[model samples]
Target: MGILQRAKPLSNIGAKQVGFTLIEMVTVILILGILVVGVSGFIIFGTRIFVESSSIDQVLSQSRFAVERMTRDIRNAVPNSVRLRTATGGSYQCIELLPIDSSTSYLELPIYPDDALVSGTVIDNGISINAGQYALVYPLASNSSGVNDVYQASRNKRFELQSSSSSANVLTLTFTGLAQFAEQSPIKRIYFASQPISYCFESPIGNSEVKLYRYADYGYIASQPAPSQMGTAVLMAENVSNNLLLEPAIKLTEQNLMRNAIVHIEPRFSVNGETFKYQHQVKVTNVP
Candidate 1:
């Protein structure tokens, strides 16, 4: 049959071929739209979760790294690598290297955290411990508050020593190499504020919780009454919302004459509808 004849026969048929009505089309479109919306929501939710998790993870890692640096330096806090001696409360904490063998040794001096008082540790790195002067304090502030460090601190004069008793105390003192000396300058004393480390940490609260602190004797104290223990500030993590810093009690153990104790810094933090835990132990000592 011709093409026109075939079409005419089909057109003459009583029943028409099946096809989708407007209702069916609309229903299908509606179902697809719903599915799309659900999938989009899921994708957005997942993306948010991932971002928050990543942020939290980064924060946790940073905390660990910073603490590690602290512990490493703290362990070496000795007469040579570090100088630890009794100081009047509220005095500055110092860190410096004395050249026993070389002509000019570098002392990093009083360690200061990068941040401010509200969110920093008091532990500083620049002041040098005049190990020779720990026993005596000059201009004695009497009690504990009077003792402090008067380290050689002139930005331009890095090699110069504080002249409180520099000439009178050192009879055969030599800067180039270790020499015999009778009297070392006494650590300066003040009635308040030992050079404490101002440290910061987050509380178990929201994302912005941050605890402000100045702690040298394991806990943050407004006034360090003891002339022995001092503190400094170390900045750990920035943008910490909750102040979760713990006031830890420390003491010299009889068994461990090094006066060592470990503190497990187990903290729980929440981010993006999830809770995470961080646990680590920090070792500290109680040395007057």
Candidate 2:
């Protein structure tokens, strides 16, 4: 009259436990390590490529902008006003130019050997002559002797404007003083120039990188001023690697009867051991 319970099988109790061995666990860990190393290597490689490419693109873009800006300035500069300068040991190189504010044909001018006058007549082309602007007549070159040079403050080549008035189709320009032009332009063309602009490539004393800078509104000087003596400088480009002693950064070919003036620009930029140079030439459109 008593109840009974079933017992476990003897075979099941004596069987070995079922699980992974030591060798199996080690093999799995080794495979996982290989996969991790491979994935990390791929990620590192992609990151390095992206970084290098971005650095190169940045340099290219900056260098291109600087070259184009310089080209535009040189093309529109006043005739025969482009000048180049360099230091004694080629530590720095500069190109100076005067931008023209207004240009027109002159009806009358006080040219030597005639008496100097304070007023002159020009064709009324809706030209505006602001104060502090200089009038240029027959500017042939910047390095010419006597009054033929535009950089000189001589009344024979350049003079300050005081006021301007228009009547019918004629514009009368009054000079700050009795000024006489050295020579008459064959086409009777006159130019009004604002302040001088300079682009200089300078290398720091203890640094290997050369930087390009722009200086403007610094007024005129008989001699080209260094970067330290010039007006506020704006950085244009960096990593310049030009050898000024071997070849100049800016070269000028004066205008003659055959061709217009040409400015040659050769600037080199480097980044990440990669270097590129621009061989650009800009021609002056206006002639005296």
TM-score, each model?
0.42, 0.85
Identify the runs in model 2 with alpha carbons over 4 angstroms from their true place.
1-28, 142-148
Report the C-alpha lDDT of model 2 over 89-110, residue by residue, as the tens digit: 7788998889888899999888
What is the clash count for each candidate, in the order shown?
A: 63, 0
Clashes of 1: 63
Task: Report, for every candidate in turn, its global Cα lDDT versus the true structure.
Answer: 0.33, 0.86
Best by TM-score: 2
